[model samples]
Target: MKLLTLRLTQNMHARSSLLALALCVGATSGEGALGIFEDHADIGATRRAGSAEYHAATQAYTVSGGGENMWFTNDAFHFVWKRVSGDVTLAADISFPTAGGNAHRKACLLIRQSLEPESAYADAVVHGDGLTSLQYRETRNARTYEIQSGVSGPKRLRIEKRGKYVSMSIAAEGEPLH
Candidate 1:
């Protein structure tokens, strides 16, 4: 919850492009699929083909296809908080309970911390297909980069930013990617 401005560094220019892409993807979301921290989200209706069960104890929500076929199509979900700046680090544990049947299902972590409710500061996502990548957008233009990892399941993703330089490291909970 600490707010601090990032100082310009050597790699600021390169990382800026990555940051921009995150904003772009974060801005566009499927209708009713996007949920904020305080919002009451219906996981089944949002994805249009699944049922979501919220676990109050863990503060995490799980979505499952209640015997219905489903895929995450433009379904965007994010946690909102005060704008964060400086050398910030964000991490999350996510999984696709139904990933065994659908490879297109996905979950993502958003960072940067912005006041603009319409967009995120920066964000990255991992698809159920075992492709880990980062996506960012400044305004209308957006970009995606594939991370080098073919393993998937339960994952812990971390994004760290120092000045304009940013780096992402990911690993499965029980095994190493290498």
Candidate 2:
């Protein structure tokens, strides 16, 4: 599908609280009211609102939102998600319409425990610069941690949730997800 994704880690100082520029995300999904999703909304209190649009003809979703960052105690990004249980998997072919935003900007396939900003969660993410990683928060209000991947600039990213552990697969440009 010729997509792009991102990931990042390491506790560095956060950027200034600037206005969130919309992140252009194009993804392939199923047909439903909002594609294969139950609903989409901002995960936490964000400076600006986020939106999600499903294109049936293209089977692509354009999701836009902003957040201070997708780490630490709270998050503020738009999420288009469905409720799933008992060993689940989520994947996406992602790309940004524009290039060269924040090096830390990301598009990810996430599994979160709740809608709350402090909910425990895990995400297989790709960053603007093509850094990919598996990031997680073990408990609500806990610090976020990351495990960097050997691969980068992946065109496809997938997350599989087993009983208690989460794993991921990544595909570079022109390669299949493995």
Most accurate candidate by TM-score:
2
Model 2: pairs clashing at backbone N, Cα or C within 3 Å: 4-94, 5-126, 6-125, 6-126, 6-127, 7-126, 7-127
RMSD of 2: 6.3
lDDT of each: 0.38, 0.67
lDDT for each residue of candidate 1 in 1-178, tens digit (9 for 90 to 100): 2111111111111111011111112222222222212232222223232333344434454443221111222212322232344565655555554424345444545553343333323455565566676544433222333444455443766556677765666776644322
lDDT of 2: 0.67
lDDT by residue (tens digit), candidate 2, 36-115: 67788777776666667766666567766655667888877777777767777665666756666667767788888888
Q: Estimate each model's TM-score.
A: 0.49, 0.81
Winning model by lDDT: 2
**Candidate 1 structure, TM-score to reference:** 0.49
